[model samples]
Target chain A: MAAEIKAPAYRQFSIAPAIQPGSMADTKTFVANEKIQEAIGFPPALVDDWHDRAIAKMGELLSKYRSFKVYMDACVHCGACSDKCHYFIGTADPKNMPVARQDLMRSVYRRYFTIPGKLFPKLVGARDLTREVLDEWYNYFHQCSECRRCSVFCPYGIDTAEITMAAREILNSIGYGQKYSNEIIGKVHKIGNNLGLPGPALTDTLEGLEEDVKEATGIDVRFPIDVKGAEVLLITPSADFFAEPHIDSLIGYAKVFHAAGISWTLSSKASEAGNFGMFIGNYQQLREIAMRVREAALDLGVKRVVVGECGHAWRVAYSFWNTLTGVGSGAADPYAMQLQKQLDHRYKQPMHICEVTWDLIERKVIRLDKEANDKHIITYHDSCNVARGSGMGDVFGGQFDIPRNIIRAAANNYVEMAEGTTREQTFCCGGGGGLLTDDLLDLRVKGALPRMEALHNVTETHGVNFMATICAICKAQFTKVLPYYGFDRRTVGGVHQLVSNAIRLGDK
Target chain B: MTMTTLFAALFYLAALLFSVGLIYRIRDYARTPAPLVIPTTPAPRTVGGVAMRMAREVFFFESLFKGNLWTWAFGWLFHVGLALVLLRHLRYFIDPVWDWVIFIQPFGIYAGLVMVAGLAGLWARRIFVDRVRFISTPSDHLMLALIIAIALSGLFMKFVSHTDVIAVKNFFIGLLHFNLQALPSDGILYAHLSMIATLMIIFPFSKLLHAPGLFFSPSRNQADNSRDKRHLSAWAAKLESGK
Candidate 1:
């Protein structure tokens, strides 16, 4: 077979491996896990003009949406945010400049959606939208990791990630969409979540996990599937089932559950909770991903649902659950009904992994031997979508301490990058939105630089070996980006790995 | 003997011309608000791309000075020198070059050379690059030409034109002190003094204000994160109403 002219690993999350005595000479070969590739069900390249219809609709929808008005109106354009962008900080490439990325989409939005833009293109400096401009929009918007680091320094708190999402939504409406995003959305619709594992695949995976746990630690760790009357339904990200670093996180959750002696089951129907719709700006898809989890709990009679460590998933689950429940008749939505039935309809239950993890720690349900998990000197990468986009500040009390506490509980030493590096001020890994796919690698790494620099700063002084994060995409991003920038998996992984290792699963 | 009265009359006339020029420029901007905004390099394509693009251009100047290292080096020196020269003139308004004043004055002259070279290169690029020349306004050329003239006159007076430095200083001190002393009677000093007065009056109304306005314009000052959220600009709202 002709060798694939492999693209360079440019962004924060795309995998690049160090040279060693190995069969393959390139880094891409080592990091490309064939199983995870199959797990995502990669789609065929998009057809031309596939997005024209969607873009028109988006032009109309965005024009009407009041929130967009608030967003565009709020920007005074102080230029304070440019240096703060991880991508611009990383590459020093002018195109990679965050403001440049936003301009590609903003000008079009102005041209089509604003009266000032339409009447006097020359006056407002707005240009007519052409096919070439659309292509530029496609290339640049996807490049945004949708990291909200820009918002931290922005005086008005204007978020470009939101604009990227809005643009993707518009693009999707026109049929101009990334196969990676659509394939994931397609999986949620056809199966239950982004990972497209059918009921059988999910059941088999859990069964296999049970065997692995029993072998690794001489304990009967049951990964019950669709078991009725369970108190909790664990909603794992598809990454947990497929992606290696995330899979390790899943094992961590399993061990934590075992040590806590909690009655939890993995529902085959809603095995995955990640919704690419969040990235693409499709609320319907976002609803579907959440609906499956809500339905799985209903179908199995579970009382609570424990979300996995996926950043956007946790964000969508928390922010949109109520809206989805209220939309189209409150009870008509099966997802809301299941939750209402499980929790006595009086109080709305919080849906997030952080909340669940914090609760578990607070309850003192599981005993942790912090020293046993001390192999890694870990630091947390707070996800922008969670920390800034969705008001995650109050959700975890003050700042990034919750994730830190979990790390501290799992290990002896916990470190931080800088004051403005995480939580509300965390730098993006540059692979958010739909930039996680292989196509927008250049833009992604360019955007990952600020966060990478922050990581470098702390890691250099503290001798911190590993970078841990709760967001699945962050893991996917940092895992790929760290190596290219001269860091490794030993330098980055999910927080779940710590929990899994620290949980006393008994002697093997 | 009555040379001080004649010099005072010339200064008033020059100041009036400067005021009229500024008013015309302000009126031009107020009329359209379009010239104030042009399709600059970092035109935002995504919703918040404008903010992000604007931010980089405004603060880091990440777009202008990045990668092209030599241009950045020259540009920085020039801007610093120009600023220092402007500040040093304040010494003329005072009785004498106070303690530590002479130290800055010489440094300013040296820095002025960097600014002159940087501006010359940029002006030259405008003529050389097809795209840049295509966008170049007559005003842009005139502004560059005038700054070069100002810097040259100042340089000539300090180094080449060896005019009566004491007499010129006394003339400036008398003007600020309101005595309006007689002109120094040196052709070079007279030309330099006239040029300095001319430049000051034109400063506020020119594109040079981009130095300050760049910090406020959304096109060059914002980050690109707003695409993740919905942004509805006031202009969009107004456009929707007409629809």
Candidate 2:
């Protein structure tokens, strides 16, 4: 299936392609089946009255989220963001343009809600919510990674990600959830993680990782789990247990803990830090998923919570975890206030693992032999969610600088990708926002064109051999699509993977 | 009714619709709940920082400057020129026009030309740019056409077929006091005033709401201090309170 889809060729310099209408109109993700939809509390199938239900859902969202209502009204169709989308640049699909993609639902919004669209639909481009429009919403909205790159460029900061999430939420309400995100959300709810690994399997995976690190470095680097009263509760993506590159970062986290002599344990109950409810724009589900972490934190009586390397997971953990579950300060509700009281006030609540590692490196709590990673030349890929959605170290742009600072501290050679493609302006990894399933491999490969081009340039100029990122999805997506573009799949790995290579295991 | 009375009635209706509609829309935006902190990052960490950022966006079109040079240039030119032209029009309503308004009269006359040029550039992109043309609806085009026509008609009155300036000023000043006064019956002047009225009537209904909407955009206006502060909306707080 991957072979059937060709990757976009790497361009010498980045340039937006001319608009090609309907170029990717046929590329749609698989719709969730009844069991998957119902597992996550969505309707089992498309309701007979889906049109009215969808419109009503949209009305509810418009009043609920200011981002939705304001974005729907604020756009002037300036085309500034038309070429900012990677999918548009890669596939040249005009509909892939951020503004055009938004118009899909905005048109429906105007038809039902606005005066001009109601009285003169043709003049304002409003359309009825037909079956065809819903399908189009599914196809194109899923194509977006919810990366927020276009938001940075828009004059009024019109974020299409907000619209996409709201559209997905409305779709799920009308019983039209995507198979990948819905399935995973169900798994996270029921099985404690997206991979659906049971407790015993997770324990076995950790035990195996402990042995692997011990054998490789002749040091006892323990991967502890579910130890009550541990100082820190680490919530990482389950991909860390089940996947390569991700597992290496897992190993890196263990080594860092071993070196620092800190008591940190992973919880089987709240094993995953990611919340797909954010992807679907379901507030109830988002709060529910986050409540597991609150439960685990309260149950274990841990003072601090540290999230591992996952883009959207960090976004949820850093941005929404406070309001949803009181993982941060200033909690007002009963549950949030309880959790907030239990957490240590001195440390950042629900800190990023990079923040943890960087703090250790800065204070010399753990030492990294810079020459230990001499074999690799590294460039950091700023994960979209982390870059644009969250921060670190209590400073603006800390998310950007801290990881690169870690890479520089660990390795001798560190180069950056193109300027525009770094920091807040970074491109999506193509497989973010729940489009990482095998069904959307073609879209994934196409959407990765911009980042791949930037990476290709760094490789030529600086001989950069490895691209390190702090996102589980970016690692997984790049590992899969790198080879399609004639680069080694092994070239992409985690930021801590480099740290793992360089960190001194025993005797500080 | 005479053209004067017809226009007087139209202007009164337009003023009412514009003010009431704009107020209603602004209130709707302000009342809507922002349940989470979703400011695009590298965002300001303080309220003051966010204000500065918003000021830059509103005054300089900072994000648009980051986006595309052509669009930013034309958009900024059009908006800035429109502000000047509107400010200069204060001379019509004020019996004793402010010294600043009098000082800007010449610049305002020239600003009409600049506004139309900017609007023309924006309109050309809508027509010529494939990506833009794909997204442009008939209303988008007609919105531009309407504004450009308004600007051109104003310029026509100023430089080509001049109207009775003192009489126009007296008429508007009289209207401000709710006293009926005969408006200048010049064709270009009537066309210009009618289009301005049309724009005012549609101001709240059309994309022109983007003006006030920009202030309410959470992504642009919110501070990136989510970790330091927990923000919950009234409706979301209800969920937690189990109400």
Candidate 3:
């Protein structure tokens, strides 16, 4: 079965992270290779003066970003966010606390930037920029998913994600990078997808999806790729083309497009939506990755753009795409002006597939046979990047409701997990912010503890045999972590996967 | 210098340090670019809506309320009480005290009590709460100690040993108008004045800058109109346009 990944269990986490001390400090991920670093225009390897270069980069970032400078200074160490992080709650590592994690950079920032720290570093607990501090930054910063859960609770609105991103960016500048995110970014640039799936491979994958849907429902649902003059360019995660349940979501998107009668095609040049550049906080690389979508849209002459099920990709698309490349209208700048003129202005630019699907369901354009999903008791896991960083529909909290509305519409049985753990205050799947690699397996499994505990409540009470989400990373991470917690790996899938099983598609 | 001249010179030095330091610090914060729209979501989409959000955060500690309640209560008490007490201090600087400042003076004493109590509760949390204690540094405790000492000394000068109000008022008014006068050198008053001077001198350099820094926090202040409007920082624009 596709659920079996053929890897040994790193550790079984039946119990959640006990609120003890120092539970997760020793864990680490693989380091990026020279080629991966060079591909993204960073240093090929660590130089002899890496410390000075890192300090210089930190200085550059403090001047260039207001949030970084303000957050570094604004923290009063009040500890409001000490227990807000799911990783901290699950693992109980003291450093996992958001205030402590930000202090890693703040201490250095003070030593270099503030007069008191410059004169009496020890009095303020400020440390000189040294090799040991760099090691600590790599260890703890990667443990953070950049989920921004801590930011929601912080009085000064100090976002540890911003600090973590800056630290990662400096780490990369000095030739220290995570193997997973850097490699994926390089792959996205080189082969148009994170998996390095070639144009011909993508075509074959789409063809296979078309055949699978055709055989299952005996309908001619098309999964077209690189079709010219299409109305919508569907930018989705590359994992959707290969992974088990993610592939199921791809099939679901094809079915929805067929039913809605919208002309859509996946672009060969910009097949991936998950941008790893945002993971490392490198603005140049982030912009370069996002511009691919615009390049694909402009090259293919598409009128509208829609994103598929992916978490951080949606954040980048919803929050940063416009500034990076005028993907949306109303921006007066040349970058936004040029792209806005080309995109058909009648539709919302870069709509979420869930929003589009929800809209169609609302108008009764797509009918769902709820009985088809009766066997599965379903609950939704809010993707962190989507829940905290982006919004959906026209309303403010529409991001939370639209996905549940779609789930409720498509499935017969739906139950929300705890109220505190759902909606805007959701927990990450432990594998977000580009820590979704085999190297960070220990952290990912342990990070999945708090979420699993929340899921346990719904699973036992509601008999929720299935956990549905809209992000590809959440789907993949849960599939990996579920088995570690005695749940079947097959229990996790996408919201669209449920939609695929329930949608009655012949004459919509 | 004589004791009177020394006190006068110190006041002038503190005024210069506070004003110049605050201006430059605020200038740096304003100049730093916010390159992304990262308001924690379900955030407001309009500028006016953003103002309301910040008002709630500053006045009520909205996010902290959602976090730990005890921390919120203490934090709120400290901040609100500090606000009232600071407002009540305007009576000394103005020749004819404003009616509002006079009305607040009664509550100002109570505010001083509340502020000390809140600071005590917070300090206890730092010493007793494991999560808080783990995050608290020596400087964190010292920052609290400095503020609490200020509040207690001010209370002592008010209720325990009184200073000559006329002389104190003349000294502040003279300092305000650049007309030198001998400041009251009462033991309690000296302790209180030096602490106040220390706070003002370190106002821009210390974590106390959070007083103004909160206003410019992009996460709290930025609108959730990322889809409707594009926000390209100068550095980002230069990079994007060239590419």
TM-score of each: 0.61, 0.99, 0.97
Ranking by DockQ: 2, 3, 1
Model 2 has fnat of 0.88
Over B191-220, each residue of candidate 1 has an lDDT whose tens digit, in order, gives 666666666654543334344344433333
Instruction: Give the alpha carbon lDDT tens digit for every residue of A1-508 in model 2.
Output: 3358989777655778888788888888999999999888899989999999999999999989999999999899999999899889889999999999999999999999999999999999999999999889988999998999999999999999999999999999999999999999999988999999999999999999878888899988889999999999999999999798899999999888888989999999999988889998899999999999989999999999999999998999888988887779876667677888888989998899899999999999999999998989999999999999999997779999999999999999999898899999999999999889889999999999999999888899999999999999999999999999889999999988988999997775
Among residues 3 or more apart in sequence or in different chains, the pairs in candidate 3 whose N, CA or C atoms overlap within 3 Å are A17-A90
lDDT of 2 at A433: 91
How would you class the docking of model 1? Answer: incorrect
Report the C-alpha displacement of residue B60, candidate 2, in angstroms. 0.2
When summed lDDT is taken over every stretch of 10 residues in candidate 2 chain A, the lowest stretch is: A1-10
- Candidate 3 local Cα displacement, residue B11, angstroms: 1.9
Give the least accurate 10-residue stretch of model 1 chain A, judged by summed lDDT: A22-31
- List candidate 2 stretches off by more than 4 Å: A1-3
CAPRI quality of model 3: medium
What shift in Å separates residue A483 of candidate 3 from its native position after superposition? 1.0
Per-residue accuracy of model 3 over A214-325 as CA lDDT, tens digit each? 8889998999988889988999999999898899988888889889899999998999999989999999889888999999898888889999999999999999998888
Model 1 lDDT tens row, A32-55: 123322333322233355545545
Question: What are the runs in model 1 whose C-alpha is more than 4 Å off?
Answer: A1-59, A112-115, A326-338, A344-348, A391-399, A505-508, B1-243
The DockQ of predicted model 3 stands at: 0.75
